[model samples]
Target: MDKRDWLILQMVYAEKNITKAAKRLYISQPTLTYRLQQIEKEFDIKLFYRGRRGVDFTEQGELLVKYAENMLKQQQDMEELLWNTGNEVRGTLRLSVSRTFAFYQLPQVLKAFNKRFPKVEFHVNTGVNIDVIQSIYKQDAHIGIVRGDHSWPSNKKTITEENITILSYNKIDLKDLPSMRRISYKTDPTLEMVIDNWWKENFSSPPISNMNVDNVEIAKRMVLNGLGYCIAPSIVLEKNDQLHKIFLCDTTGSPIVWKTRVLYREELLELAMVREFVHFIQDYH
Candidate 1:
């Protein structure tokens, strides 16, 4: 099928309604319906079950739509590569980063990159460090910036090291306090171990109960509202205007510092745009 047909299929699967998909694609409802019918007839199978409210993909339709989505993404990437192969760096650079890096690290880098390559557009996804790593491995993102130590398939380089600290709003002494509602960053294994060791060394128990938060922004909010206190990197906690540092925790060793890095698979490392971005980061330090 044509690109339009694939686009239509993708949008239909996403929206699940002929009329809504038409509206989103800027086409008429009849045109969308006719195109869908043509696809079903060509495949000799019904793709969707029409309902009074909207539509739903059948079992076979779901499988086809999944492939259609992947095909569309590859096509977009191909077109972008062809359009941007000249002197100027241009194309959509998909990135996934942790909120910790997004707020504390990426703004300046992004500004400098934009100044250098004005045509390069960024599509960023933010989550915990683990999600960022997975995104890069899956080829859903070209690059990832995240906290803690990570080992990907190939080409992992450290960008920066962040110092972490425990913070609280209350005036209670941190020495051997057992009843504490502690908020935790849902990131890497190393960070979790560091935090666990920090607790074992400082407090009598694991801060009463631990609460895991997906987003660092929300973790800061909970600390501000007195829901719980969290241990975060100074790079992130220093920027929080609402929360105040309760104690400067003493880690036995070099402290639980997060080492932020960029990872790439061998196949993607040789791409022109990828090399430019990687070098931009490497030389920035």
Candidate 2:
């Protein structure tokens, strides 16, 4: 099968629904179905059957999926070899970055780098720190930019750090926090632990957070609207925002800081494109 055929088989098999696969491949449903029929016709075997829930692969289909996977893997390897053969640093550099970093800083970083090396392309995935780590471990991302400290067995560097702070529309007293409504946003385990530990150490009772949101941006907006106070990394704060900021600190009076770092496997540095991007990140900061 051709590369496109292999891709069609892989996407359809992975998604299990023709509609979803078609959307991912940027093709019409009719086109995807026609391509599948063509494949089955050439192989002279039924590949899959539509089911109530989704498409179910037949025995022959499963075997063909394996062959397609192997062929795609070999194709990827061949491309990597060819990319490194020439002096040009040109290839798709996969990156997994924290959603916060991706939102605030990554766009400018990419724009500047692309201006210099227009040949290189980026495939970026944004999520929490744990997701970024998992992406790197699974070899889905060549490098990861993650927030907070986590155990990674390979190469990493702390790019920046920011204080975790209590933000509010008006001045707030620490003693009065338990009575006031607070906003809590879903965050990585590391930051959660940091905030929880700080609360327990400083106060006897729990925070009365009524609003639980999915992300820091939403929680920050709630605080801005005079809804409630929120504890978050100071990176979310804009210079013009008229919010009161109270920094979290250990009993030792040291500020509790959230760190952002870049993680990578040393072996990936063999690719000149990955290596250049990594260096660009260091110099960019």
Candidate 3:
């Protein structure tokens, strides 16, 4: 099988549903089916069995999936070696970044990097910190940018830190927070834990949340409208100068900090592109 065939196998294995795989591969369902049939025919074995819900890999298919993963990894290593031998830093740099960073920080970094290495291409996956870490672990992304601290069996570097604060439209006392109308939004679990811990330490009762929003941006807007207060990372409040900010601190009086970090497998650093990007980001902040 060729590179495309190997890639198809990888994508199919990653996404169990044929329709989903086809969409991700940017091909027609019929085409993907035909290709899968060809692969099975060549190997004289069924790769996967389709059920009512989705598909399950057969024994032979599972073995082939492992082989396909190794082949793809080797292919990438060979390409990296060739590029490095020639002292070139140009290739697809796959990245997984936190949703908040993707929205506020990634665009500027990409613009600067693109200017320096016009030949390099980027494939970015934006999600919560947990998803970012998972993508990196699965080799779907070459690097990850995440917020808050978590255990990772890989090389990690802290990029920056920001304070978590209680935000409101008007000046408010911390003692009154438990009784105030709070705006809550969906966020990463680590941040949620941090907020929960801080709340537990400071109040006997839970902070009343009257409004529930989908994301931090929306919650910030609601707070801007004087709907309620929110606790958010400092990055989210960079442009909101008028907002009253009361920085959260631990019992010892140190500011509660949210850190952003870059994570990658050490072996990926062998690639000149990956190494260059890592250094670029390190110097960026």
Candidate 4:
């Protein structure tokens, strides 16, 4: 019906429990229930089915939730767009970053950036490289921190580069790697092809992987426990990790390296906040 109603639907759908939603919205449970009943009656639909556990949205309710989400996003964008027109560097900065970089280095970077521009707010998301690229393409995020080798036709600057490494609790020879247990984790498809190509270059057969993990951190844990060795970018390797690092090389004896870059849409550079951030981040590394 209105902005408040839109928010009510979004929060109720997100939390699924009216009590939790009310708490988050800073309203009483009865008030939220009444609002929901009014909304349902006005639309002449059974929005949700209440149960002992929580609530399940009916088909119509799900559709309305999508509408509510879109409205809220548009509202946020309108406000940020207006802010961008001002001379002050104060607005939301939608930033998506690679998960590995988020874990290892992002906090310090954010802290320094905040010190430089205190008025700017951050709406940050972390995922793999492809997700970062997609956010920029879709304009869901103004900037993205992407990793691995990529061909971006627009504005991008390198933050850092590191070799793809074989990490182990103890030192081992490269010739023994194919026979030993190898830890594997899900990564971006581009990196997947790179690793697969590199593997085929060195060995005639597939690796003998004993463990598969959801992310690089879990695989690193397995390596630390001496379960198996893992191949990953050396960004995760730290001074205190105490793990043996073996950099992978090409057939020509050149080390295989991956880069992290800051990617942004060309037109987004017109925003003062975006321009300042793009420059600030490159100098961050």
**Model number with the top TM-score:** 2
Ranking under TM-score, best-scoring first?
Answer: 2, 3, 4, 1
lDDT (10s digit) by residue, model 3, range 18-106 = 99999999999999999999999999999999998788999999888888888988998687577677756788899999999999899
* Candidate 2: segments with Cα more than 4 A from true spot: none
Whole-model lDDT, model 1: 0.78
Clashes of each: 0, 0, 0, 0
Report the lDDT of model 4 for residue 208: 97
Residue-level lDDT of model 4, residues 59-100, one tens digit each, is: 999999999989988998788788888878888899999998
lDDT of 2 by residue, 1-285 (tens): 799999999999999999999999999999999999999999999999999888999999999999998898788878987999999989888899999989888998999999999999989999988899999998888899999989999999888889999999999898999999989988888889999999999989998977999999999999999999999999898878999999998999999999989999999889998888889989898
User: In model 3, which runs have C-alpha deviations exceeding 4 angstroms?
Assistant: none
Candidate 1 regions with alpha-carbon error over 4 angstroms: 14-31, 41-44, 51-67, 80-84, 169-173, 176-190, 208-214, 221-228, 238-252
Candidate no. 2 TM-score: 0.94
Ranking by lDDT: 2, 3, 4, 1
RMSD of each: 3.8, 1.6, 2.4, 3.2
Candidate number of the best lDDT: 2
Judged by TM-score relative to the true structure, which candidate is superior, 1 or 4?
A: 4
Q: Which model, 2 or 4, shows the larger lDDT?
A: 2
TM agreement with the true structure for every prediction: 0.77, 0.94, 0.88, 0.83
